[model samples]
Target: MKIAVVGCTHAGTAAVKNMAELYPEAKITVYERNDNVSFLSCGIALYVGGVVKDANGLFYSSPSELQEMGVNMKMKHEVTNIDTEGKKIAVRNLETNEEFEDTFDKLVMTTGSWPIIPNLEGIDLNNVVLCKNYQHANHIIEKAKQAKKIAVIGAGYIGAELVEAFEVYGKEVTFIDSADRILNKYLDPEFTNLMETEFENRGVKLALNQAVTKFVGREGSVEKVVTTEGEYEADLVILC
Candidate 1:
């Protein structure tokens, strides 16, 4: 039997490893758009806050590890098209810009989620970034180091955590969200209220119940965040 797995994140890595062990006789090929696999994205805040001393520690699995399990690990390979009926897929080698096709008896897709970016003015300006994967973590850490005033445009788990991290790192952080409270979707008002108080005590500015209307920049770099309630000065903006 031949199997093809698209994506090599947590789920993809788990599926590939389990299948490789359960069906030793089967041939498996894993396609990953990124060069690395199985990154612990939840720890991104810790990493950005200097809690995680090594960036390499974020990755739980690697291509070489998967390859050792008798599985073909195709790093930097994207599955451009999948023909389910024909059991074939068109692939592109990102490094070489080469395209090719491969046949598989079975297919598994574990393509993960991406951050939702709003269509706000000046969003594409420098220092406006999204937090989702390994690359974003590194970018945030790098940008946070140079930014005096940092603004995060989401109050979810990641956004709240990032704001706290930035606050501990001595950066002036402004936490913004459309909802009335931080982590409204994940936590109850009681919990969020306490968290809000804690954050406020640490001098982290909370801009809840305000929707971001636009981002203001000077000379192609972000300078301010304009929200429904008010505008705040920001040297770096992170859209969680």
Candidate 2:
């Protein structure tokens, strides 16, 4: 049997590992757009905060390890088109820009999501970043080092964690969210209120219930965030 898996994140990694072990005689191939695989994105905040000394530890699996299990690991390869009727897929090697075709008896798609980028003025300015994946984590860490004021544009788990991490790093952090409270989807008011209080005590600014309208920048670098409620100074902005 021949199997082709698209993407190599958590789900794709698990599928390939289990299949390679269970069906030892079967031929399996995994295609990932990224060079690395199985990155623990949840640890991004810890990594940015300097808690995780080694960024390599964030990845649970690699292409080398997957290849050792008798599975073909094609990193930096994107599946451009899939023909279900013919059981064929068109692939492009990102590194060499080489195009090829492959046949598969079975296909698995674990393609993940991308961050929602809002349409706002000055958004394309330098120092504005996103929190997701391994590359994003590294970028955030590097930017955070030079940033004096950091603004996070979300109140969810990752956003809150990043806010706390920036606070610990002594960077003036402003937490902005459309909702009235942080972690409203996951925690109750009482819990969120307590967290709010703690953040306030630690000098973390909370700009809740406000929608971001524009990003004001200076000389191609982000300077301030303009929201529905108020404007806050931010040298770096993280869109969670």
Candidate 3:
């Protein structure tokens, strides 16, 4: 049997590694758009907080490592289209922009969630980014070095943790969320209130119950965030 796997993040990496070990007799192929794989995006905040000194430590697996396990690892390749009935997929080499077809007896999709980018004014300005991948994490860290004030949209785990990191790094942080409290989907008011208080104590401004209407910029860079309630200055913005 021949198996083709698309994506090599948390899910894809686990699937491919387990399959290669369990089904050694079967031919396995892995496709990853990134040059590296198995990055723990959850550790991004830790990296930003200076707990993790090296960004290379974020990745758990590499293309060569997968190849050593007798799996065909195709890095920088994107599976553009999959024909389920024909058991074939159209693969594109991102580096050379070349396209080709590959047949497989079975196919697995481990494509992860994408960061939702809201349509708003000045959204494409410099220093406005989304945090979801290894590259994004690195970009955030590099850009944050010069950012005096940082704003994070979405009060999820990633956003909350990121604000904490920025606060620890001595940057003024503003966390904006449409919800009434941070991590409302995961924690109760009692617990969330404690976290909110802690954030406030650390000088992290909470902009809860406010929906970001648009971004105001100057000199091709985001300078402030406008919401339903008010506007806050931000040299860098991250959408979590």
Q: Model 1 reaches what TM-score against the true structure? A: 0.98
**Which segments of candidate 3 are over 4 A away from where they belong?**
none
lDDT of 2 by residue, 1-240 (tens): 999999999999999999999999999999999999999988999998889999898988889999999999999999999999999999999999999999999999999888999989999999999998889998998898889999999999999999999999899999999999999999999899999999999999999999999999989999999999999999999999
List lDDT for all candidates, in order: 0.93, 0.95, 0.93
Per-candidate TM-scores read: 0.98, 0.97, 0.98
User: Candidate 2: TM-score?
Assistant: 0.97
Ranking by lDDT: 2, 3, 1
Q: What 10-residue stretch in candidate 1 is worst by lDDT? A: 137-146
Q: lDDT per residue, candidate 1, 1-240, as tens digits?
A: 999999989999999999999999999999999978999988999999889999898988889998999999999999999999999999999999999999999999999888888888998999999998998998888888789999998898889889889898899989999999998889899898999999999999999898999999989999999998999999999999
Task: Give the winner by lDDT: 2 or 3.
Answer: 2
Query: Model 3, range 67-142, lDDT digits (tens) per residue?
Result: 9999998899999999999999999999999999999998989988899899999899999999988889889989
RMSD of each: 0.9, 1.0, 0.9
lDDT of 3: 0.93
